[model samples]
Target: MLIGGILRDSSFFCIKMSAYPFFYPMAFPQWKEKLLYWADSRFSYFALTQGNEHSYPQNPFDSCFFAGNKELSENDLWQKRAFKVGVLGYDFKNQIEKLESNNPEFFSLPDLCFFVPELIFKIDSEGIYASSRLSAEFLSEIETQVIPETGSVTCKISPQITRESYLKSVQNIQNEISEGNTYEANFCQAYSGEFETWSPIAAFLRLNQLSRMPFAALFKAKNNWLVSASPERFLKKSGSSLIAQPIKGTIRRGETASQDSENRKKLLASEKERAENLMITDLMRNDLARVSKTGTVRVEELFGIYPFPRVLQMISTVCSELNPDTSLKEIIRATFPMGSMTGAPKISTMKIIEREESFKRGWFSGAFGWIDESGDFDFSVIIRSIIADSEAKKLYFGVGSAITIDASAAQEYEECELKAQAILELLRGN
Candidate 1:
């Protein structure tokens, strides 16, 4: 009754909450599934997840919010409005003057808008705490509502680019590096499939179990869904301090523990991986400098090796003190497509990427997360993700690696396959 009544209140700002937090005795999966079911029934909705059980500073909560009870995809998404929670698409690059996207707009999840959650939950070691500004009556109603169970999803996959074609594209990128057209380029391949059991919520839960990263997100707009398990943080703002962690180098994990340690060491010691990391780091610094106070941009971590389930990666942390005049538009204008997804000398490399890759990235390489009323936000790079269209029974996953001069065509192709293994395995209904 509270949701039924409060949702009609367009001027609704916040909900009334209890004097203390209520501890709900429920597992995270059940909690998440309930929220997913609630969101699926809403018009515009989004859920930003860390995917891990423990809470970290950057990812403190797994929050879900919905805007209208009806779906809308307006191009005015960039019109200088404050959006507390929403999803930005990869094709948004075309709106900027420097980048262009010729890829077909086959997916409907291009851009979405959602209102701040009338219901909010924070899960930590203590317990699940519910927070809301709505009436106590409404809170009680939500507490009593029962969440239904999710059924299984089935899928059959097909590659958009064959092994030979991906190899050829890698060769072409290497040739570009040789010609001095660009220092590095991120080359991607697409894999698509037909699904009988295609529940976005279920797929996301499985991906979360397989790869528990710091920056995971679930975005559902009508029939289109973006379920991601990404480890890369594109941007985060706390006061005037802005932070970004760009991942550059990747190598598959070993079958044995000893071998895995050796892989991490190898990635750390490799001059090639470090060079790639540094190149992207420098690019990020330059982009940040454009909106940052002079001489404020600095690298907090350099060539730090972080291990995932399938691979170990080289990531660098770059930070900057923001200039008071910098707007969200300026921040995005300077760094629309992140450097990790695009190689060094971003402009030139993006042009080469468009020419090389066969399919458009859609929302794969873009950023999405939450931005509050105070102008603070956190967004994650859209990698290690799957986009599904339940209506068409189609699902797509895109994988790519940063191609440097020292890169081998065969190894790069294999790297793409390694990166996609988790989601591919899930699609196989494992």
Candidate 2:
């Protein structure tokens, strides 16, 4: 099965780069601008930001930037091709990640396995697409220019747990910490409401513009749409080296320039934030060690403070040398539903989280990214994101913070708001 835009002109370059049927079109310098087009013309669409906004010769063959629409569901048969895109729901942890989830589900994703998209478009200076045969009218419609505008779509957002309830949950987690059951746990809450006419494409565009995160992604599969501006990279594989940058600490950005600088410094100097970031970093290192060569797991960066549009985050990069024979599935099994999202003593903490949190996380904290045929992959934590169910007319976003021994429940609640600010504002047409 094939997909993509109709070739308007033979001048639009084409290259027989591989054994598979593909076409390389050399038009539209900015591939992201084509998202609305694909989302409208095809049933599946995915866009990964490569952070190449001003770079020249932007279409590198190995560049991470890619957009595509699924031709059909190959089900679990993803080994045939090097490329597949989809979400791994949180519940999948019960089977693959070796954790149990007995809590009832509030929002569930359709699939946990990789999906082979029908039409894959790799974004570069020249975009790549599968050959298609659609009507000229439809083709023209897709190619038409879109003047981006923030839609005035509003939805009533109510937290699943009230402030008092969240505080009580935090205290419960601290009790577990005090009991030595777990060192830290991530606590999250769901903010959801109905927006029957919400436009995913527009919301994603505005969200991305507001916060151009390193791992930003916009994905749509059937009725579900995910718009992410996540800065934490769950896992990335390049050749034999594996990298996971887990983010654990966050502070809201300051009001003024000096204040912002001071906030960054404060985060850098905060023992609490550093301890939180260090724990997650160590957790990731241990997770990678499972699939990595013995003595290969190492922390490359620790407590590295990075400023975002809304918050200042402390991130750490953990690196390891992968065992060549390690399969993609094994790698994911060793480390998924990323530690940053799960917390330390993974299995035990997850059990506590399930018992405490009000809603099933679903895809909110799950990983999403591409896996090439060569077994190379890069996935980002699904944080700072919005999930919209167009069919159900409901939109949901989850926000959480790491709860440690010395954590303040009130402060943690505020952190969730800071993390959610951008998407919330975009949804409110702010």
Candidate 3:
């Protein structure tokens, strides 16, 4: 079954297979030597629906993985149908070199990495589909491999910054807001630990099961792995339409249904939360306006509350019709290290982030997703993720919230804890 299209004999071939429950986990071992990437849209109702119809807007594949052949340079990324998988690190921002602090050498992921894959597998409501430069014989081999059972994983981790230090940083950011240095800033902290026994695939599956987020992904580049259960979309491009969904406000789920309803109401009614979301929404609108057609930028959805297993989030969607002449590089440069990850008056707020954040964000506040043959792409903000370096036996993740003048240092600390709870549970083998 030919998918996408027929290429030359030396190019990729396509096939269709019956969907198997264990396809994702087993594919890892079979393609151990290749750069593997998997993105799953587990909760589609929130991201894929508009009005009464369920349609994938910027993403064509609801769930898919790519086995890459070689890394591609940034200049080569926008070639027609490049079909690349990669990530952009938070340090991609300008004047990153001015920051005095950095993540330790073990967490030194590159600022940018994208690969041209030789094999692709897409799973949808129908079944599994494959496109590859490999032979049909190899494709059959993948189908017959035994599915490995999920294994246990355990680790001990500690926050890089003490609670007092975190609170102090928040206070400093609030001071900056008050002094007119910036309206808001995102201050982040890290947790680091050594793994006792590691099973990357198992840990990823467990995390995916626990979060069941819309933009779940597993990315491997050599010994480094990024297992993400992110619920926020950084950006997307489909035809002339460009969209970005920024998540600003978060509240933990309640123990009971009535309590959960009350909490949602409280989040909706919050003056501080609304202020936070509004500031970033305006930031995004201004950014998108740079590359957008004249007078085309607008906010599509404002303060839309969405639920996950552990928390409910306030997400606002901003969209614009792009200028036909705009290039991929221009689009990214205009709206990256997303506004929610930074803050209002982006440049000054980012400087505050660099000075106040405990460590370099690496890929934490960056993005990961695919660019398809049509030149359309979709990327998720790299939050709620674990960055593991097997060679160093080290694993770490970063979490933060936007701090405005009215922010409470103690309450912001609690918000970070709520964000880290899933990864903490996974590390403890809970």
Candidate 4:
């Protein structure tokens, strides 16, 4: 840490860049204007700020920007997207002179872990970011130009999500599985028209319009790197220990306060829900143990019931102090495609999902965050996000809950509806 140039007195606001540094308060009115104006000229830039809080400076930094991560070709898998993670900011300022003494890859890194809470940091300009205050009222200036011409086709919700269709789909998945097919294929449907849009910010408001969970974020790690409002943490690293909190079960919030309390009570006692939550929790524990000390991996919390605007969820935290020699990338390689996103036997589920799903997930399920020079990192699962290829001008996000025999399609669909709230509202006029 640079004691001299630190964004003094600001615990959570600090940039990793020494050249074109960025550090700001929780809410800044004119920050975005300055960024848009200087982005082209700066030796470096940052996308900082958090807007998912539903509070001041409405526009928070949630964009992923870096020439390092962009696709230069139409045929490139990541072309037009900046979801490939990288280390950014001035965390490496002092390390610059010592590059000749260490492995370059270690010096320059992928954003595989998230540590260091609150302090603003940036690296070589690769990682997820968002502009402060811009999102607060971004729609006012956003006029839909014709959806840019695209090789990818526009999608529409043929059967708008309703209790009926959602339940049927669940039955369909179960029937297919009973036939010995697969477990969890992330089946997602569209909810928009060619001209109509679902603004991400608006959807965030509508769904999370109520949430009791902490650490929600609307992150733009880059364009393909976006999370509308993710309320859970996939993994974290601190000292020798690694932590992961996977949210498994969910039930819509009740219509009345008393009803809501009852709903929470039932969710706590649901055997199937608890089982599903534990499976993922165990999976996460195993993932962390890969880089963690033997016998050190343990579940910190189990089936911890949490409240969200739309539903009640069961989240469990699994932690293990990392092995001394472990690398951040190895930890991610083993744990990513988080169990919450992919079902048990992750590798098999991923294969099933890739074969069945029509679109490439891009950064959707991938991790996004900043890893400074020290390998200290922070990453959120890519759920509740909008993926866009600016050159082509298309966007995508999906909502799904885990499927179990006892799962109800109606409630799951409602859960999905709650998930899409933000994006749906943003497209209001479009």
Instruction: Give per-model CA RMSD.
Output: 3.7, 5.0, 6.4, 11.6
- Between 3 and 4, whose lDDT is larger? 3
- Residue pairs with backbone overlap in model 1: 15-133, 15-134, 16-133, 16-134, 67-115, 153-197, 154-197
Native-to-model Cα distance after best TM-score fit, residue 364 in candidate 3, in Å: 0.9
**Backbone clashes per model, in order?**
7, 8, 1, 46
Give the better candidate number (2 or 4) by lDDT. 2
- Where does candidate 1 have its weakest 10-residue lDDT segment? 7-16
lDDT of 3 by residue, 33-88 (tens): 12221211111001110011113233322566565436777678756546677788
The number of the candidate with the highest lDDT is 3
lDDT of 2 by residue, 123-219 (tens): 4546544434344454454556463454435777777889999999999999999999999999889888786577777777678788867667777
Error of 3 at 142 (Å): 2.9
Number of the predicted model whose TM-score against the real structure is largest? 1
What lDDT tens digits, residue by residue, belong to model 1 across residues 1-430? 3563232332322222342245555433455466466556644555646546433334423433343443333534333343455666777767765677876544555544444544344544333454434445533434554664445655788888788888888888999999999999988889888766667877787888887777777776557778888878888877798988899888888999999999999999988889889999999999899899998999988988876777888888899999995777678778878888989788888899999988878878888776654566778888999988888878788999889878888888888888988988888866
Please give the lDDT score for candidate 4: 0.49
Per-residue CA lDDT of candidate 4, range 327-397, in tens?
A: 65466556765778777656555444444443444445555555434455555665665544333335556
Give me candidate 4's TM-score against the actual structure.
0.63
Q: In model 3, what is the error at residue 73, expressed in angstroms? A: 1.9
What TM-score fits each model? 0.87, 0.85, 0.84, 0.63
Cα-based lDDT at residue 304, candidate 4 = 83
